[model samples]
Target: FSAGNNENSIEAHIGINGEANLDFLNIPLTIPEMTLPYTTLTTPQVKDFSLWEKTGLKDFLKTTKQSFDLSVKAQYKKNKDEHIIPIPFYAKDFQVLSTPNDIFIPAMGNITYDFSFKSVLITLNTNVGLYNQSDIVAYFLTSSSSVTDALQYKLEGTSSLTRKRGLKLATALSLSNKFMEGNHDSTFSLTKKNMEASVTTSAEVQIPILRMKFKQELNGNTKSKPTVSSSIELMYDLNSTATGTINHKLNLESLTSYFYIESSTKGDIKGSVLSLEYSGTIDSEASTYLNSKSTRSSVKLQGASKVD
Candidate 1:
């Protein structure tokens, strides 16, 4: 019989000049083996035994399996408009082994702009990045084997700007693009805002195997203890293929309202209450994908009363 185990870890960092970093790692191990009882018999007698004769049970033996894991990541950035230039860098690496004999490595890197356009209400930012993989090796108790190495190169760029229209009205726009070995992806978003309400929308499209996506969000609240808030999101994707096209869509909506109770020195009591809720999601898949959609929902209701 075989058994499996899983482990996970997360890390975070923050530095001076508005630099932040985050990382996550995971590992899984599995081992399988079999055992059999010894029989009382001579070499000729063993051959005569029907139990051993029916199948190749004598060839079975217990075995042990082992695996290894390693992950490394780091990010640093500093931005100051006073200085003409800004500096930023990010890097990540992941490795895995099914058995002590096999090894794999995946890596990514990024470097971006510094802080010189701070004075402008509307500012632009950009970055260049790359992702690649190294060759893998497999080892056996007696010998070793290696696989042909492969690498992927990527270049990315982005820009965003915000402008104030009037006393309480403002708008912002963002655009980004990523170029891979033989594929390209691009995204754009726009937002309009005012004192009482705001509206925002975004869209993304990828080439070489066409795909598209869109999303929107809205929010508002009042000072009352039992304040109410709600939000909704929608996403869609279209896949082009030789056989046919596959389309997928996801929608999510949620609302929450809650209040608190307080007591005074004279033993007086007060109470506030409201209803809360949430909902949304996409279908599950056999394995994790770089781009996938999922939805979540939640709700709550509670109240308390006091007497003096």
Candidate 2:
């Protein structure tokens, strides 16, 4: 059991992130296949709006027009098993509680959340972001960490200089890190009422692997509507060759389909093949309509060894 409060304490920033009041209790778990024999930690936490008025979060939620979320967060983590490859099953998280938000205290419009995806120094509250910080913590649980450290106030501004009639022309700068740490393997998107499609370009530098990737994604504003959409990605590394991919999905009342393809070559011009793969799926279980096949899947491979 654990208890935290700033009322009668010397420090006002009592819990991590200077949260005036915070408390939680962690239950332990044991596993034999792991190194520690004690395998995991289960923590149930609760947050209320007692001392939040002293925080930028008070302004953040107010400006974004979002009510404070008092949801119960049960945190879980499994330590890395020395007997197995080092994959510490913990929650990979970084939150800038105060630093960046101080940049633009008086935000004009749009939701400017505490920046989480970019470069910043991590503070004591488990928020890890120091300029050029390369150490990667294994966090398998993706909801996120409880507290934050630094902050960067991203201007809630939009540029429509390139916008043309009937077509959307815009660009955005959001903060996001690698995928294995957060949302991947599945996709969940939200589109505003007046928004139609989005074209986004992103560049990522993976420090641990010394790898970098540049990608572009296009998404249509067809959530409850039936339409065809596509996303294309391009990537390059210093020691490796360039690669490109084309992925598309279609959702309609009577039909649904998806297609994806990616390839890499040894050299710029005619060169040895490196790897190529593409897969497609068609189904109706999730959609209102039914499919000729409950599920269909396929893949094509090239210039790679296949094992039985």
Candidate 3:
């Protein structure tokens, strides 16, 4: 779920005035998925054909049922640097209201560092001069169960070095025993023996190079006739310099295999009614220095019928 690196440098400057400096650097990367059980309320009811013999509502009620699914994924990274300072100190224990019963001494050190990152979320706390001459560092990274738990497995690695020609590399891998289902919502209903169904699928992926996020979705219904629909979307980082915040959204729509359209729109709209729909989009961005991002979204409608 997470990984990190820590390095310490003891610099000795030999000059008119001899000086010693200690510096520490830390970098961590994490991908965590957090998921919560989807909840819904269900009600049982009886239906009679005589009640809606001539109403379309009766036909609609007879054919459809409803269901929902939700999921989320988050990615995170953090870097920290600190200057270390050693202190000479000693501590003695004594009775609160009487003469000292025992005496002890301990050495201590202090450190200061700054941390920051994205996608996976994290919190950090660093303590200087803890338990004699030691520095304490701690962090937590969290992700949506739908994202992290869904991955069958993952592999990660890191490499770093200073002015020296030597390089240090570390790698990690993890696998999940359970399958994480993608985000999906569906409705099913029964009218007599005939059944009707509708479903929607949604998903998101993070692109670190461009510092952006991408998402896509599809929604449609199943009927005796060919009824299909789908959508796509993209998001990007508008401010790559300051907060690294992102702003982007593109969309696409398709009907069967015959027509396709990509656009940004709100509210309700209608597209061709075909047996299938195919839609997709690509979202990417790059900053001037050390910042790049990319993402993609796609949807397809398929059936036994063949279309060239």
Candidate 4:
């Protein structure tokens, strides 16, 4: 993500200056160094990924806006006695001579086209841009039953700002309305230089789901990755209809590995887990012998019944 504002490399600086800047809400944004994730995305960075993850629909659609990205996806399923197949070729921003959506294998089968657009955004970081800016984003989905109608639509919006409000805070407020599920979600995040706190509230019915996270980092030696950290998270899930909390700790060493552990302070299945991940340099001989990179990584995870 923009290389975390490094200053030592001449090439990095040259790369940054040789970029074409775009605008999102007139924020002097740029195309991502990588491919754009989708077309409808707005940049900087709201931490709304978890909200989408909880909805279990994040992985269904993917899009890219650069460098001729393409994907062929197929799904298999069983229905009654007939087997059906649907293959879709996704291409970005290309004016097609013919519609790719209609080129199915078994003509006029049960398979139908589902045309959807992915939400993607890329941005540039400026001292006086993007911060404190708010916007409302809406999506329109077409009906499969009829091409002219709408099956469902969803709207999500966010406003974020970072300032030295006595303690250097980056605050973000986000809200989402998913009419397809009759759900309205609100999330708030406040992060200092070394600490972050977030709360999310969503309701599908009378009992609203609430989640919270609070974290603090010690010895801030990195920008994107923290060296030492501690956190507590509380969650109430609609499925379990119960509440749970976890306390977590992390210790990371650059260019090598990291260790982490967590304990559930409360949950339907109260438990804890400890894990360690190590990467880089497993032996020069192994790297040469295996014809692989000079790096190797390993992970271990174990569960514990208690927190105290």
Candidate 5:
């Protein structure tokens, strides 16, 4: 992570870059054999007996019982074979079969499935940039995987500029500190005045189930935490103060997607020792498209007409 600025414009960047090579050689991986015992009720079988002696319709027909056992097995061979995988459980000739039912036999007893492949190389990168000029706010992200090389993703953001009297400012600031009892403080502040401003960021991500290729038998989880915030404070004179901020976040996953946005502003003017102040906040959050169980939003407004 680094930041620098010159006479042209102010710029700052935060990035995480990594590369990894994974090779698995004859790893002892096994799927324990599972036995499923099931019972089947066959069609009614009629009892042949002396017609007039005694059997009525209820006694004539009787249901037949049958029991069956199903065995599930996998084929894994160890002979100094190495495989590199981009994702977990990724291999060649890997087949997933459903459990057999009475009507359909998915596979015979002890079906053998192969999970073997080549080695995998993975590369990942993520970046977030804060800029004060519109022309210098666009950024590009480059990444690679076992399947593809040199994949580029473009990310763009808005730039802010402020002008007062005859002074113009374009700047980026970052501060991080750790103190007492594992407590940590981290903050990224970008200011663009007298111009339209936006924050641009990009990240390398794998969509939960789709990219991870998680099986129903195995559990997997993915979470993303991206935040964008902007605030402006204007000082017309020492007797007056004003500030405002807007923050938004959009999170998406295989099972759910969430969006949140909040904006608040406050202003105060001092009359000798007394002061008048007003503030309002609009906060909202709700799920979109996928899940609705995690949904809620709130709004708050407060103001003080007179302060002594």
Candidate 6:
């Protein structure tokens, strides 16, 4: 006898090879459940031998986990669209031969890297000119064309002698010593409706001194390097003198007078941080002397301030 089950029912049959068979047509089967103790799943006092820890499998897993994260990031970056930025180009003495548009960077994945011309063989010449008035006039051998042209136009239409004299004096000065530093030229006209003659002189002096001094200031803790502070002080002095004669043509005799001005600047430095203090004083005197008749005036001014 043999037993089998199908969709309809379970069956039992008896048969022999190459012989007539008779069969039990219908039978039913039942499956019964078995019970186990919960203690079987509880942790045992004796632990299982760990091949994973002994073979460093945990470290391997950790490393591979990081690799998985990197692989995911790489895939995400690869699937994204490329970004492009325009490069501003400048040229003075060289020319570009070739430019590349795209390259692969590990940090940024596939990025559009623009590498341009780096090396080329070329010869170049540049000109930079520095000139003083003495040199420029010596080169041209005459007044500048612009000044000459303007003077010619003004000379044709002007009738005032003082104006003509002023223009001539300006041309002479420009041709001779316009840019001559610390040069004093004395020439004046006393024949106009309002006649004035003056000599002006100015001088500037600057003295800069750098000083280094050790200052012990605690930054925060005791074991760090001490900060070093540098102090700079600048002293400046300016002197201006004007000697002149004024003729007011209106019942006042020509007066000869002189004016003197002096100014002194001083600076003070303090603190580890950058700081500056400045003080200045100005002294001025005006005096007119003619034939033992003299008038005098004087003024003094001072100021100070600090900056941080």
TM-scores for all predictions: 0.20, 0.24, 0.19, 0.20, 0.19, 0.17
Query: What tens-digit string does per-residue lDDT give for candidate 1 at 186-281?
Result: 222233431333445555556555454544444332322222222333332333221111222222222243222221111111222232222222
The sequence of per-residue lDDT tens digits that candidate 3 reaches over residues 1-308 is 22333343211211122222211111222334434458454434433323333333234333323222222222222223334454434454642344334433323232222222212211122211111122222222222222233322222221122222222222222222243213444444444433344444433333343333334444333344334444444343323321222223333333343333333332211122254432223334321211124334344322232222
Q: What's the lDDT for residue 10 in model 3?
A: 18
- Pull out the clashing pairs in model 4: 38-120, 41-120
Better of 2 and 3 by lDDT: 2
For model 1, state the Cα shift of residue 41 in Å.
50
1 or 5: which has the higher lDDT? 5
What total of clashing residue pairs does each candidate reach?
Answer: 2, 13, 22, 2, 16, 0
**Candidate lDDT values, in order:** 0.28, 0.32, 0.30, 0.30, 0.31, 0.26
Q: Candidate 2 residues 1-308, lDDT tens each?
A: 23233422211121122222222111223334324346575444434434335444444333323222221222222222223233323334744333222122321111111222211222211221111112222212112332352231222222332222333334333444332111122122334444455455555665543454555554545555544444444343433332332333333332244322222222111112356433222222222333554544444333332222
Global lDDT of model 3: 0.30
Angstrom error of the Cα, residue 209, model 6: value is 16
Provide the lDDT at 292 for model 4: 33
> Which lDDT tens digits does candidate 4 get at residues 56-107?
3234323222222122222222223333464456456674444334432422
Query: What is model 1's C-alpha RMSD?
Result: 27.7
* Candidate 6 Cα lDDT to native: 0.26
lDDT of 5 by residue, 172-248 (tens): 32211111011112222333322222332221213222111111111112223333344433322322243333343
Error of 1 at 130 (Å): 34
Error of 1 at 114 (Å): 19
The alpha-carbon deviation from the true structure for residue 29 of candidate 3, after best TM-score superposition, in angstroms, is 20
Better candidate by lDDT, 1 or 4: 4
Model 4: lDDT of residue 217 = 27
- Order of candidate numbers by lDDT, starting with the best: 2, 5, 3, 4, 1, 6
